[model samples]
Target chain A: MDKRMSIDEVVERIPNGATVAIGGSSISRKPMALVRALARSDRRDLTVIVDVGGPDVDLLLGTGRVAEVIYAFVGFEVLGLAPHFRRARQSQAIRFQEWTEYTVMAGLDAKIKRIPFMPTHATLGTDVLRVNPSFREINDPFGEETLVAVPALKPDVALIHVNYADIQGNGVILGDGHVDVLCAKAAKETFMSCERILSSEELQRFGRDVQILRVYSRGVVEIPWGAHPTGCAPDYRTDLRHLQDYLKAASSEEGWRQYESEFVDVDHPQYLTNHGGPEELVSRLKV
Target chain B: MPLMSEFSVDEVIITTMARQLKGEVLVSSVTAFGSLAAHLAKRLYAPDLAVLSTPESGMDVTPMPTLTLGQFLTDVQQGIPLTMEDIFDAIFTDHFRIWINPSQIDQYGNTNITCIGDWSRPKVALVGARGIPEDTSHLSETFYYILNHSPRSVVQHVDFRSGAGNGESRQHLGPHGAPTTLVTDLGVFDFRGPQGQMTIKSLHPGVSLEEVQERTGFPIGGGEGDILSTPPPTADDIRLIREADPLEVRKLELMSGPMAAEKFVNIYERERQTLHATYPRVGKLGRG
Candidate 1:
């Protein structure tokens, strides 16, 4: 069955205060267009789950749409710390639960397998256990070792951006598939935005690169440059100059307001125009 | 009239870090300096070393002059592109060794990349704990490289324990072990003292023991007689570092504020120029 839908329609289906998993690791392959759409919508008080985040988390925090965040790390690698996230945390603006990278994966794994919890040696003695007390310690059934029980992290929805997809909801990631597939499997519903939409036959040629199966996706939107600011590898790189401008604007409240008005509040087409148009973006950001 | 040192502090630290690795499977995180040290080791002594660049799976990646934000994508093309799960599994079960750059590291080798001050309401919020907790708990060996060595960074106790150390509470936690050595701008150190206290292994040339003691927050181990001068980088080692990182990206670790910013801009411009020269067609396409 054809599962294609518009980005706005996908956003409209999401309820307020839902647990949404944002796919991608730091600075790579994030579903930013979907995130921007969610921010532009009237949705509020979201609990975002991300393994590694960059500007996507910060933008939601800056827009005051997020009430809590579950993440392992949220800083921009190399560029510096994320300003809005830092400010929000420092001021007690939002509640956050920190987990190690492994625990986050383990939690998702448990949910995917339909298990109550997963066992791992991670987060045993670290202060992560102290902060996130929900994680329990259980003795090994067969041995003397103790393991941390990572509970299932079942998201209400998962949003991901991919390099290629079909109307049937099958997707292909040309670069490192950084837990995007896991997030899709772990969430109840998954939506994907693709840089290009191909026929099912054409997508089949990718073989193992086609990690996102059709069964995992509820909807797919063909949105070119969907991972802008972040990157969709083999197609374009991160718009570093734009990210620098974002950092500059995010430094102060007034700057952030101006940025939101110029970029965040606009439609995807307007945002594309404001971000130097398709021609400029392709020329500069293309790998 | 000023005296000049034979080697910069970064070069010596890189060399010292390289000396510790023995051609094993090494994992390196985001720090350019630590990555460069791992690359240098692979090229010089540990030719058999397998370097896995994390958060993205780029195994046995070749060296680059400067690392862009999308470096993993570029490196993954040259080598294998494993998923995040594969990388985490390797670190957990394979007993790979790793080097981390933490915001705060205590004497017992406990490190914190999380928030500072209180965990509930932090005085300063840092990047949340990424992989250090699992890396330290499961890896065969964990090492640290610090660009800035001061009382604030080399603290008495980390505000948050993002990585397990040799603290009393961690005895039965089944951690692989505390970090073996920590290389910094001032010197090299090991947790060999009684109760896993940080002991000075060697001081960089021209640095006095008093300077290290003053910079450290706690009373450091290793007596004056026991401490040795850190061996300076050989000519070959310096050449290898320069060749691997021609734009001197490793130097940014030692600098801060406006100086580092200015240097970074210079390096970025040089990197662009080099890229254009090497790939003229792609460069013109990018510009046009």
Candidate 2:
């Protein structure tokens, strides 16, 4: 099995119209490098499944790389409004399948369980579940009585970012699991980007069950401090200041190109060294 | 500034609001402004409740509402049908309500929706009053929280009354038949008088009585009741917030830590440093 490959190779694996699952919560444990790679790959008509609901999604939408999105919410980190998601939706540039937080989790759970669908009581009355008939809906036996049902989400691939993993593909969520673990389990294929590849013995010594790793992960890449400007683990905080820059830059074509050239086009490790260089990089880098 | 002992006063006020909300299905966008109050109600009063967001999924910290500019427009164009009153009805048959954030709230708890200058030619643009119309006029009760207790925010006659709970608009909209509570970082105020002019109710922790007086946009009316403090999270409240949802702890930690402690985490500052340090820019051409 190929444990690592150039970003172009990873992009090649994503079919033109594939539905992909992305893991992370806001910036924590996000595959920012991989996302930038995919964006630069010029992949179009793709559907992205995510849990971040923030600028990660906004960047993709703004670049016109995503044809549709299935998400719960898209606000700024702490303030109100994710302006990019809003403007894109307003223009109808992309289609959407909306869900409440619970139902989205339930849908992923259904996929992991290999079930056809999941039953949920969320959005039973409001117009949200009604908006996306593909995944969001009401099971009406009769009358106004309704039961909300979210369709199972079986993505073509799940792209995840984690703190550490072993040669055998056993991954550990360093601090918080976020949604990456769930997305990995729910997809048909799982690709993880990690900081360090531990020896198999060291991973087993930790003792927490690497259930998703052995069971679901198809490939893993060792990209030290992969989620930079975002959190890694046991080290620094998200470069929220940098993230804000991404949001502003990604809003325009010129800005995005500048972002792409500087960050995305590099070996994963080089990307890190280049962005912050070695020492300041060494200080904050988790791996 | 009220001492720590005064904490119970805020709790009582919050509990008073909670008591009235029992049995109602509640709904609200996730915002720090109303999140604590909403979280309190969700944990204590509305457990079986569900949260909805405009972003379909894959959006925010949790899959909760991630506010975007367009969605803000949607929320404004078509007010989230899940009205505060509707949420109240779910909490209880009679009515349910929430204490929301207002940009510029006034003595009558009348919130400003339009621009500060003339409605047509406003100097500074504020988020137009999105749901205040329904929240103040239709809900059985309305509550307002002003985080920054400043003179500009708590004014005499708001340039434009976005949601009406005060004298003139109250007469125009008639009554939705509910009392209003106005809480500020400085102090607590409540609607009194026939026209719903806000009367000083309580002061918050670390706020001076004189400060509250000086910051008012307009003169406050009624008895200067003993000002009070807000309740710290109860053990049970903390437990549910931390465990019932793991994200709460993580989210709070992130929000409270060093990255967040910046006086201002501006891209400009970051850009200057990133450039000065001579590091490679990841996405585009800029510094931060």
Candidate 3:
């Protein structure tokens, strides 16, 4: 793999109207630099897909780049509702479709297997399966009517964030890995941002299983403080402060741009240090 | 008109009405029927206290008098015998939870959560027993909210029962008890009916026989020809629940009228567009 490119070089690679898939649940382990870059790009008409809903969904939804979002739950749990997704759905501002939690995961699995659609009974009988034509219930080999027919969701590009990677795009997640690994495997193109770039020997110290470099990754960027409030591998604690600010900005379009202008469009990642340290980052991002 | 305590439907109404009766009871208000129940509760019976849980939190929003679950658990560990009143206060004191009903609940009135798919090889998979386990197994009193009635939700046999208040899960629950009542848009229902088959208790005002049939999945058991309209909530119900909590009350108002619900969704969309525009992902490395 090529050595890590400057943040601006990475920013120039991403264009408008891309169907991008983000890894991690909610705000955990999201590619911070990519998110910053996207926010700075000011592109629109984006289609995004995530497993379970979270603030990452909120950020894009709030920014107006997302023309469509597909997921299961959007609300904060039930405090009120996914006020953002709810309001959007109510007004037809963006297209809304929901899949059972399993189907969404399995869809990625299906993509990994290189299948158009995988058959498994997931959301059968419920309104969720019946409403979506893309999903179907087919009989198994035994002629038994079971299995939810789930179409694969192969994203055009996947933005993955992790703990570490080599200059060659080899990476490590150091935890459950969830769907992040699967996202990398399925996406046609992948941009992996890591906390640091490890030498081949340092990566060897972690052992072979720890590394995730393969045909899937195209570029690797060393973003030491990339995850920020979001959790990094080995080190616990997500960037709650930045997440809070993201939530607040995401709650409204005007508020989102103000946030975007400050954190996303910086000339360099070092500006993150001067614009105030971690404390400022957290406080400013908190809604 | 019969008081809410008299019929199955009344029991459902009372669950919400009791909240109003007490001054203010928490209602989930997720679906159309739930919103109606909360609206009625706010109108007729007002509760003294109410709380709301966000989606960020779990869907189960029963509140305890104390702060966190750990605190209550600690109190229990210290030989503090938790009382029915303590549990009821916790559940009754909350705003609402989104619930799903099942076809043919089991002996203890527990609903089905298991699926045809085994852990390994499975035909169909479901979100088995999501909240039913906690809501029925632990909560003092649980509300079984059903939006549409069909053999699916109201049936002779449930494929798998998760939370048992009286029957199988009963052994599991030991003392936590089970559902307090079942509320449907058509009418309130009671699991106390013959063989624990739900029986109709009361009907909402302006509801007709045809409307009830259209909404139900089971054969109507009770509230025969003599059924009467459920009493509408008084003005006090509105002032306390609706006017009192702006965030929750606003949602209640939005659900009050279909047109209003639609309007709320419209405003929600414009905001979504704005968010997406602000955080556009750049080139997005990918094969596509």
Candidate 4:
């Protein structure tokens, strides 16, 4: 079965008000091309889930597409706090559900195991419990210990970017698979965007790096330099200059609109051209 | 003896943090200052220490002295790559120890990186609690490195508890332990005070105990005669720190405002120069 599709098709499958889990941590390996496409699309009321978000979460929120965000941390690492996310949260422009990195994983673990909830001692003594009242405290059935019950967070769609993928939906991540596998397992459907599409035989050469099997994916789209601005590991590094530009533009409403019109509203090829070109991006971003 | 004027306060904090590690498995985030301490400790004190870099999910990473951006990418390429799930599981083990950097810490050592004021509508929304809760709760000995130690940072009470500390609130929270020590610009503190309050362990050279108390929001333990002077970094320690971070990226945490911005630009320029010098053909890709 050829499970390949265009970026537009993947975005079309995700309806408005859908719960979407984005793969990547902070400023590495984020599916930015697909995220940009989603931003260009008229999708609205998205409840986005991420462990450590970077520009992807900020872009969605900046475009007013996201209604809520369920996340552990969302910042630009050393670059400073995410301007759009900070603005949205401070002004009460969007609702947010906060969880620690462990609880976020535990919630996904519950979904993967097909359980109602997973018990953990993560947020017991913290005020994170007060903000998120849905997470209940209960005694272990088998033991006498109190634990926070993290409910299963089942996303309707999971968007992941990888280094390589075959037409059969097998994906390979050259770098750390930061919760991307868990997102694929827990989501109802998973779509992958890859920098390159290889043959089944070529995919096998990656050995253990082929962490995403065909069974876990619904569709795979070939989008070279897909994780640009962020990174695709041994292939390229983050375009910090571009991120600094993004930070400056995202600081204000007018600047954000100007940025969207130039970067987010355009097609992927044009977007590549705007960043110089494929050659420039590959040479510059390539590790 | 390295003179007090020879090293910055950041170097003192880094050496102090490095001294606390005993060749244990150390998990570190992408923060520049904390990661430097971990590297320094591994290099000088704890050669056998396993440094697990999080978010990137690299194990035993001996990273370049560049900031988090350069270091994390280098870590992914050089270190053994593991999945985030693998890292999450490793945190619960007995060998797991981590060093964290939080925005705010209270008298009882509870940390808050979530918000500044109210939870419903925060005055300033900092980054949400990342892994502090889980790391502090599970690890037997967790360490902290606060770059700036003002009343705002060391508060009387945290607005939100991102990491469980040695406070009254943590009594019923299973078998979790409080933070072992907090390495700050002023000095070193531990939770060995009365009722597990943050007590002064050592005052940095030239930093009086009165100054530390005045800067702290709550009353600190270890008054006057009890306070010990933080040992200055030896000449060998200074040489190793400078060798590990030639561009002086550790100084970024110690600076704020326009000073930090100027320093960041300078560091990036130096990094780009080093990159271009090494790979001449890789110069055409616009200023990164």
Best by the DockQ measure: 1
For A1-287, candidate 4 gives per-residue lDDT tens digits of 89999999999999999999999888888999999999989999999999889899999998889999999999987677898888888899989999888788888889999999998888878888879856998988998888889999999999999988999999987666788988999999999999889899888877888889899899999998898788776567677668878988987778988999999999999999998898987666554
Error of 4 at B25 (Å): 1.4
DockQ of 1: 0.54
| Docking quality level of the chain pair in candidate 1 | medium
How well does candidate 3 reproduce the true complex, by DockQ? 0.04
lDDT of 1: 0.81
Docking quality class, candidate 4: medium
Q: Kindly report the fnat of each predicted structure, to 2 decimals.
A: 0.59, 0.01, 0.00, 0.60
- Candidates 3 and 4, the one with greater TM-score: 4
Residue B180, model 3, lDDT? 62
Please give each candidate's TM-score: 0.94, 0.57, 0.52, 0.94
Shift of residue A46 alpha carbon in model 2, Å: 0.8
Q: Give the TM-score of candidate 1.
A: 0.94
- Ordered from best to worst DockQ, the candidate numbers read 1, 4, 3, 2
- Where does model 3 sit among the CAPRI classes? incorrect
Report the number of clashing residue pairs per model.
0, 41, 86, 0
For model 2 the TM-score comes to 0.57
Give per-residue CA lDDT, model 3, range A118-209, as digits (tens). Answer: 76533433434434557876668777455557899878788888877888787876533536766787778788888778787676665633
Error of 1 at B138 (Å): 0.8
Cα DockQ of the candidate 2 complex: 0.03
Comparing 2 and 4 on TM-score, the stronger one:
4
Name the regions of candidate 3 deviating beyond 4 angstroms.
A75-83, A208-211, A250-254, A267-271, A278-287, B1-288
